[model samples]
Target: MTTTELAPETTGAPTRPGLTPAGLVTVLLGAALPIIDFFIVNVALPTIDADLHASTATLELVVAAYGIAYAVLLVVGGRLGDSFGRRRLFVTGLWLFTLTSLACGIAPTAGTLVVARAAQGAASALLLPQVLSIIQATTSGEKRSRALGLFGATGGISSVVGQLLGGGLVAADLWGTGWRPIFLVNVPIGLVVLVMARKLPESRAHNPLGVDRLGTALLAVTLLSLLIPLMEGRALGWPVWSIALLIVSPVAAVAFVHVERRLERNGGTPLLPPSVMRLPSVRRGLMVAVPFFGAFGSFMFVFAMTLQEGLHFGPLGAGGALTPLAVAYFTVSMLSSRLVARYGQKVVPLGGAITATGMVALLCTTLSAWPHVTILELAPSMVAIGVGNALAMTTLFRIVLSHVPTDLAGVGSGVMTTNQQTSLALGVATLGSLYAALSASLGSRDAFALVIGAVAVLAAIVAITGRRLPDPRA
Candidate 1:
């Protein structure tokens, strides 16, 4: 696969309505909703627990269940979009997400809410893959770069906005529904998205491959086994089943690899095309994405809790605190394309080092201020983190998708999205669990800062390693 050979496969034209700025905004909004929902719920969870009287284990499940289901099914969702139509899947997923969100809002018990959240995650999986695929299949050059940058910004911005808005909704208890408002708020927005999506052109692979049922199941099982225990085990005191599940994760994952290999060798479409795994750019990019997203997930989850439970900030306060991050992320993300073009791959590692510095600053500030610090005090560090995230996050997306062939765009998008979702879930589970465990001994606030700071350092290491990867051009 030389550069010339890959060049033809990368060219694409934007869909009819999607070619316009309004169309781009519509598509981006549809894409942003799902990502936003994933993180927004973190802030509202405490409110849900208090209002609904849900236990800690159930609350953990509420978050983890959604994340795991979304991660597992994302590849399948991408394939479905390819076989059917990206526009079709987008509309269907959005409607389902809206409905499920309503169910989540109205649920009377913790179990029901968790189930609804899982359904929401599944709908999200269906909706999200098509976003990148649509962008890949429908746009090229400056248009592609701009759309991708918006996607990157949306991802980082949503995490911050989700927390902020979730806090506002829960606190305002709009229409006196308390935490229910958080879920119900999506309905009107979904309806608008549905209409806009219908006007958007449909796109799909000319010759779509059949779904890989076995690979999908195995991937789901592997992720669930690994993620479930990590998220729930600590809160539940490390139960026997949790430990057992952790032990079984590797076995399940190994089994999955074997199954995928057999499928590929036999000429069947595996969940992820095996050829993708062999691509140097794809492989290295995934390696970089995993720890990066994992740390990201853990950071959002822990920070949400730290503000609410540890620092006793109100919903508005917690959400408001993240504003600096959102601003910084968007500002710096806009500059990432130019940076990558000029600086090449080194920009990513630079982003990581800057992010590391921000985290270190935050940790120091938090440790010194303890229970007395306000959002204003955290603003400077938050802005730095946001700037760092903006640079690294956008670069990561571009790097991963940079060399993918348009023919296999669907699966390629799926692979990258699944890696992201899984890492995010794992981050929340593993790093979140670490924070929870350490909080018991070190006090909640300090424990969270310490754990998050450590994870950020590790993410910096991953970024530095990514700098060594051969550029797609190379």
Candidate 2:
């Protein structure tokens, strides 16, 4: 569709409590919690394994289960929020996340923790979509754009903090609790958000669509079919069932699209509106988002293990290593919105190139340092990576949601978040699995560098694809 066609005229939708600044902070806190938990487990993996006497593959399951469950349920969660109420669903999700986190904290075994983590992921799925949907439905023009920028900043900052805090929490051993405090920390935070969230505005589609059970099931099936095999296949030594499931994934995805299309045609609500998928902004923005987030996930997972298991750093030492990245991401992200206003679509690919440059530096540094790699040696590259991440991340969300009709905010945000979460999970399952496999054969340093190289290549591709983004003036 033409730009003129895509930009729908504004309407005067009823607002609740004026979507106050305090309320926005509350929702962003809710956003930080889930994203934080997703990566926080990276540092704690070794501690959990030692504490529970779990196998390496089982530990992988601890991460994979949460990620997969989050990815699969995110879209449906968005649909529910759209149909019922955004504030209601967001609060409910936050409360459930708190309880599931507690379950993770006190779990007696790795299996129990894995189950609890999956529950936490589901709860996160419910909470995160609303942050963007609410912003999309309630705000517009520069305010909406800036809110989206902060969402991206919140995501990047949380990731860095998650890595940093996971190690800190593990090392502090609060009340001799070790890693338990990481999960337990959410309890008090959630309670506060629930209270503050009472002031947040509520909005939904004027003509809400009914839930599509068949499409939702098919989407779940499709994502699981792909993820289960990639994540578990390596651990199981490539079993037939894993290969079979991988083969079935594409078929499941096609079936899901057919179902969504049919639902839309029949005047029924689909899990994701097919019309949204056709938007140029979404199609192009994803080309950058997938690689950006996938590389990010792999970096966090690989670097945590490399620092602790390969280099023998202590928990705090490991977390401290990521501080540079956090600083750089926050610094650059704060500037990204202004840059976008000045540079428009060009800033995204430029950011990708810079990010890749950092990865390349990291690859060289890792190969040079080998087994004795230190945090100081990694700092410059980490800062570079952070810059790239901030620039691309801030604009990508705005680009994807730019043309979405206000009424479809929930579903649009759901689809956007689902892509991000799914890519993140895939990064762990695919690149993470690759790192693990190569670490066994190529040795730790070489394996880590090779993955960095792979990441750099992916970033370069994002830069090339990002040029296709619709012009801001359009």
Cα lDDT for residue 431, model 2? 84
Predicted candidate 2 versus true structure: per-residue lDDT over 233-262, tens digit per residue: 887789999999998999999999999999
TM-score, model 2 to reference? 0.89
Instruction: Assess every candidate by TM-score.
Output: 0.89, 0.89
lDDT, candidate 1, 1-474, per-residue tens: 000001123324555555556667777787778767765687787788788887655666787788778877877777787789888998898999999989998999998998999999899878877777777677778888888677766766776678678888888988778888888888989888888876777877666678888888888888878877777776777899989998888998998899999999998878777788788778888888778778777887778778888888877888888778877887777787788888777777887777788888888788899888789889998998888777777676667667777666556666776777777777777777777778778889768767877777776886678787656444
Residue 118 error for model 2, in Å? Answer: 1.6
Candidate 1 Cα errors over 4 Å, as ranges: 1-25, 55-57, 132-160
Question: Taking the candidates one at a time, how many backbone clashes does each contain?
Answer: 1, 0
Model 1 compared with the native: what TM-score? 0.89
